[model samples]
Structure formats: structure tokens, C-alpha cells
Target: MSEAAYQEKVLEVEPYGIEPIPREERHGRARQMFTIWFAINLNVVTWFTGFLGIEFGLSLKHAILAIIIGNLLGAAFLGLTSAVGPIAGQPLIPASKRAFGKIGVFGLSFLNLVNNIGWLAVNLVLAAMALQKILPLGYHSALLILTIATLLIAVYGYNFIHTFAHWMSIIIGILFIIMTVISVQNLPALLSQSAASNGEFNLGMFILAVAIAFSYQISYCPIGSDYSRYLPENTSGKKVWLASYLGALTVCIWLEILGTLTATLGMHAGPMDFFAKLMGVFTIPALITVILSIFPVNAMAIYSGGLAALAMGIPLKRWTSAIVCGGIGALLVSFGGGQLADTYKNFLLLLSYWIAPWLGVVLSDFFYYRSGLAQNSTTNGWAGITAFVIGVIVSVPFMSSVLYVGPLAEKYLGHADISYFLSLVVSALVYRVLLKFRSAAVPVKPLQFEE
Candidate 1:
């Protein structure tokens, strides 16, 4: 069967992998992005990222402000990458191959491998923890169950994921809205707490809070276009961009603020556990909601990772690649579940460090060199790789992590990590300069790829 025929049914395994989607196979409304992304962020991880803002020493108001600013910036990057899908008709990293050659994109594949596996492990561990709360299920048992459940959806591929996300978006959105109403009761106690001297805003920490939310949302940029490449080629770029921006921005802010409210109440526990406990008589239902939510978010991670494998020339189908990723993620969960809160925070930061520089090159190629967007070739890509490396090297000194704290971060940023922002700016500037120099010498024309 042809790719489109096999992929027409939701349950039929998808045959298209990293190859440019055949136009006949292309289908989906741009509005689906809004629901897909809205459902994607409706998970414990998104909530916890927001909760970290409060934990980062911000008052509820300051944390909310940081979240809004951070998400606004991050979601725009996500939308831009996602918009590339309909134009490029390939997975995100593959769409990027023109900027970075086929060989050069392997670096992206490696980074994506780590990013997806790390996030899948984190989500699995959290969902397992929630499952344990739902009953007396052992952590390992719950982890294994969720790992299988999440893998099934990922392996089932794009149509399945889209259909699954559509219904869950509505169902989960309503449940959370009800939960939001209940959460407001916890807010009155915060007025006195906000008046406390400890509520004084710390600049470094406030910026750090913004960076986390920014990193958490924009980190998806690497894999984002994979989800939307199936949209018709003529799909409105404005609609595509708006759907991605609003869908992710709205839910992420809502959940993060929701997390902020719960943290300010002196709840000392993980996000799922805290929410379950705070819900009082609604405990069972709340836990059930969390348990049900594990698949949508984690499936996206696994699905994108699967495509990254194909883009890297891995000799496996997308479904098979998803299984490999699932296995690795399960191993991560088994070996590292200690000090999870700290691990998750650092993981979010580490993700942005690489992605920012990478995105800088992509956005520059797409918008600045508009003609370059029409190119179907993957060249040696020295310009992009060089800019990418230069971006990372220059920004390392500004990076502050437990693994390594740059002198600049220690001396001036109060240990806050702003490496992401630095790399983004530096990389774009370097790449554009290189492009200008290259173009001035040679009449710039698109290079076509040959088999």
C-alpha cells in the first residue's frame, strides 16, 4: 500500500517516516494545532515548571509575570518552527537539513535523542508516581505500565496521535477548568503571604524563572514541525503560527499559574501528589485525571524521537524507533529517580542550552534568507555548524549548572542561567555574517540534492 493509503485509518500504522510527505498524503486543519498543543502541555511536567518559579524564590505575582513573559517569547519560537512544516513538508530536523547538511543534522539527532529520552523518562516517572497514589501500585509496576501505554500510542503514529489528542483536549480541558475553580479557594491565604518580607523580588532568580518557562516551551522547537508537516502545503502560515502560539501559550501559563497557587500554600510534595492531596474529596478523580493524561504529552515526545531516528538514517521504521526510545526511557527511569525535582529543573536548562543556538540558525535561515527556504539541498553546512558551535562556546561562560558554573554566571548573574538567550543572539548574528560574506563572493543560488 502507498503511504497515504496505509496511513488513512487512525489505527493503521503510519508508513511515512522522515521523507518529505507526499502532497496526496497531506491532510489536517491548522486549528488542530491549537487542540493538539493545548492537550500536549496539559501534563504534570508543565505544571511543575511553573511550580519551580515559586520554588525559585518568587512571590505568586512575580512568578506569574515571569511565566507570562517567558511563555510569550518561547511559544513564538515554537510557532515559527511549526509553521515551517506546511512549507517544508518534512519532519522538523529534516526540514532543517537545508540549513545544516544531512551529515550536520546528525548532531541534532543526537541532541534530540537525549532530549526526548530524558523528557520521556521524567514524564514516566511522574506518571508512575501518580499511579502509585491512585492505588497501591508499585513504582516499577506503574512505570512499566505507563511505558507500555505511551509506547503504544507513539508507535500507532500520527493519525492516531491527532485523533487521540482531539478528544482528550476537550475532556481534559473541562476537568482542569473545574479544578481551577476549586484552586481559587487557596488564593485568599496568599495575600498575607505576599505581604511578607520574603516576597521581595530577587532579580537573578526572577530572570531564572523566566528562562525556565521559556526553555521548557521552546525546547519543543527541535521536534515541533514533525507534528504539523502533514497539513496541506497551502495551509495559512498565519493560522499555523497563531494556533501553535496560542495553544501552547494559554495552557502552559494556566497550568504554571495553577502550580504557583498550590506551591504558595506551603505544600511540600511533588506536583501530582500535591494536587491530589489539595483536592480533598476530589482526590480520587484528580489522580485519575493525572493518570489519564500521561499518554498525550509523552506520546508526542516518543513520536518525535522516532522521526529523529529516521532523519539520522537509523535503519528502523518510525514505529520500531519509538520502541527503541521507549526502552531507553524505561532504563533511565529505573536507574535515576532520586532527587527528581532537582534533576527536572537542570534538565530543562540543559535542553535550552543546545536548542537556542540551533533555533537561532533555523530562524535566521527561514526569515532572513527567504530564498534559502526554497532550497531542497543539504550541503556541507559549514556556516551553520560553525555558527552553532561558536554560539555554544561564547555562551558557556554565562551558563550556570550544578555540573559546571561559568565564572561569569557565578560573578554577575548570581548563578542564574541566561546561556540560552546569549547563544540565541550570538548564533544568529554569526550565521548571518557568514551568509553575507559567502553571498558577496558567489552569486547565491539554491543547491539541489542528488541521490
Candidate 2:
């Protein structure tokens, strides 16, 4: 009743950096492991540290709305993809190939590459800023230190990261608790501030905020299955599903709520300034907590980037890939990655355009078209491509702002979150229509299952 549809024969596995697991060892228990995995991955540091909700929306309510909507939608997407993880026993990039086609995976990869690189760069600047505060070094020296530290973490690979997360979580969790306690004590009045004081309560801004938050992490969450794959073959998909859903929802709320509260309390300083204000007397512990929390998460980013590069046939070891990519990210930071906010906005729009449809096609293809939910043969189908193109085109008018082109455009057209819903609708519709013509295409292969 069960068989592995994809052959174990490694096709350029060296290049892809994907070593197939022996069939017998494929599944595992999801219990505490998934929670630990999810907890470590929560990585709310970037989301909060950057003042994204406040800065982007220019209002507390706007920020809150973005946070709430973004996390909810993102979690929903993660749930869809994660369910496929245990069943198929494949990582995100590979499973996605079924929808995007082999070459089309590049479309996803390219957008992901840009997004990750941009994110990595932003963090690099952030790390540099943090280091510069602690030390007397110039911006250049600080950036160098930031790059080297991030590289060291990245080179050590996942085992090191897992350990780092376990220990760091204990420490950071304590610090976060302390910080929250402190904030609540001093900023008691923040609770009364209106979320819509700056027009954040309006429908457009509210929806946009949610769209931004949702878009920010869609690329990141798709790869959750890659890490979750280490579980014992007997692991239930429900465990993975719960872990992923709760993990995203919890962190998004944690970070965003804090941010909204912080904004309301008038701590709306720049990133480093905000940290300085909050960490006043306990600067050392605060810095320690921040570094420990951010380092591993950034390492994971570079690690994933390297793996993706390897998967795309780059002749680099995983560690080498990490070092190379981490170094590049660090350099971007050193060279004044100050344009990160702008980069993020544009990237979000572009990504939303590409991914909304890609996701629609993937979900539609897997849940509706392909009966084999897990363990299947791979096919680079046209369904995803058609959806992707349609999504991008439809999002064009809406995404036409400074983020995509330049500052001049933003000055003229102003920013809006219209791209979010537009792309999703376009992608969903296009995918459905494409499925009608997909009959002549090669039938998707089902996963190999063992009886």
C-alpha cells in the first residue's frame, strides 16, 4: 500500500547539498522537539528591534494591525506548507519544485535570495550599530566585528545552532521577561494610548500593516520543514502543524505587542536609541541578550542561503557557503546598509507579488490536484508559473511606489498595501484557470511510501 515514488539515487546531490535520508529513518516524534525548534526560531528580535510596525505605519494602531494580520496570515501559510513536510519528507525548496517547475524554482529562489540578502544586510548594520555602541570602534571596525561574529556562528552549522538556541533561549527568555516587567512598570500609562492616534485605525493602513507583517516572513517560514525533517519517522503531522502555527503566532504577538506598547509609551526612538533607552542601567546584560538572540537567527539565515545556493549547484560546502554569504551580508552592513527600511518595503512588495501567487498555486496544486499529500514524485509544473506571472502583473500598479523604483516615485505615488490582496487574488484565480489546461502536462509524481 506504500512505496517511495522518488528514487534514492542522488542526482547531483553534492551540488544540491541535500543528502537523502535512509528510508527507514525518515519520521520522528514532534512533541517537545518541535516546540524547542519553534521557540528557538521565533526570532522576534529583528521584528521588534527595527521598529517596523511604528516606523512603517507611522501609528500604533497601524503597527498593531500589521502585526496581527501579518502573523495570522503567515501562520496560516506556514501551516499549509508544514503539513506537507512530514508527509513528503522533503524540504521546502524541493517540494515547491512540484509547483514551480525545476527552472521556475529559480523565481522563488531569486526572490528569496534578494529578500534574505536584504534582511541579512539589515541585521548586519544592526549588529554593527550594537557593537559600535559597546565599543569605541568606528563604523567600519564595528561592521567588521559584526561580520566576523556572524560568520563564526554560521560556519558551525545546525548542531551548533541548536545548542546555541537552547542555551540562548533560557538566557534571552529571562531577559525578555525582565525587560517586559521593567517596561510595564515604568510605562504604565502606555496602555491608555490610542492605537489609531496617527490614523493607524483606518482600513487601508490596517490591512497594509497586516500585509507587511505577513509578507515579511513568508519566505522564511516555508523552510521550516527543512529543520523539522530530523524528527523520527513516527512523528505526527499534527505535532508539526501545531508547533509551526503556535510558534509564528506567539512570536508575532510577542514582538508586535511589545512594539506597539513601546511606541505608545513614547519610546519611539531609532533602533539603537530605543535599545539604549530601555537598557539604561543593565546595558551589559541587555547587549548580551540581544547578541545571543540575534546571532543564531542570523546564522540560520546565512545557513539557509548557503544551502539554497548549494541546491542551485554552487560548488561550496555548507560552511563555506555560510561564510561567503555571511561575509557578503556583513560587507553590505559595513557599507552603510541604511537603506534597509526602503529595501524592506520594496522587497516586501516584490516578494508579495511573486510569492502570493506561488503559494496559491502550491496550495491549490497539493491540496486539490495532487492526491498524494506526502512522498511523491517531483514535476516542475506550469500551474505555478502561470500563477506567478499573473500575480506579478496584477500587483504592478499597486506596487508602483518608491520601494520598487526610487524615492521620487514614493514621493509622488505614496506607499500603500494594495499589492497584498491584489497578488493573492490574481494568483489564486490564475492557478485555478491554469489547472484546467494542466491535463496535458506530465502528471505529478506521488511520494515514495513504505508499507
- Per TM-score, the best of the predicted structures is 1
Candidate 2, after superposition: displacement of residue 395 in Å?
2.8
Give the per-residue lDDT digits (tens) of candidate 2, residues 40-145.
Answer: 5445453463255565555665566567767777777776566555555556665666567778766566565555566677666666667667778887777677
| Candidate closest to the true structure, highest lDDT | 1
In angstroms, what RMSD does candidate 2 have relative to the true structure? 5.7
lDDT of 1 by residue, 317-372 (tens): 88999999888877876755524535764665565588999999888777654443
Q: Which stretches of candidate 1 lie over 4 Å from their true place?
A: 1-3, 6-8, 336-348, 369-376, 439-451
Error at 427, model 1, angstroms: 0.8
TM-score of each: 0.92, 0.81
lDDT of each: 0.80, 0.60
Root-mean-square deviation (CA) per prediction: 3.6, 5.7
Model 2 regions more than 4 Å off: 1-16, 24-28, 32-66, 192-200, 337-349, 369-380, 400-418, 440-451
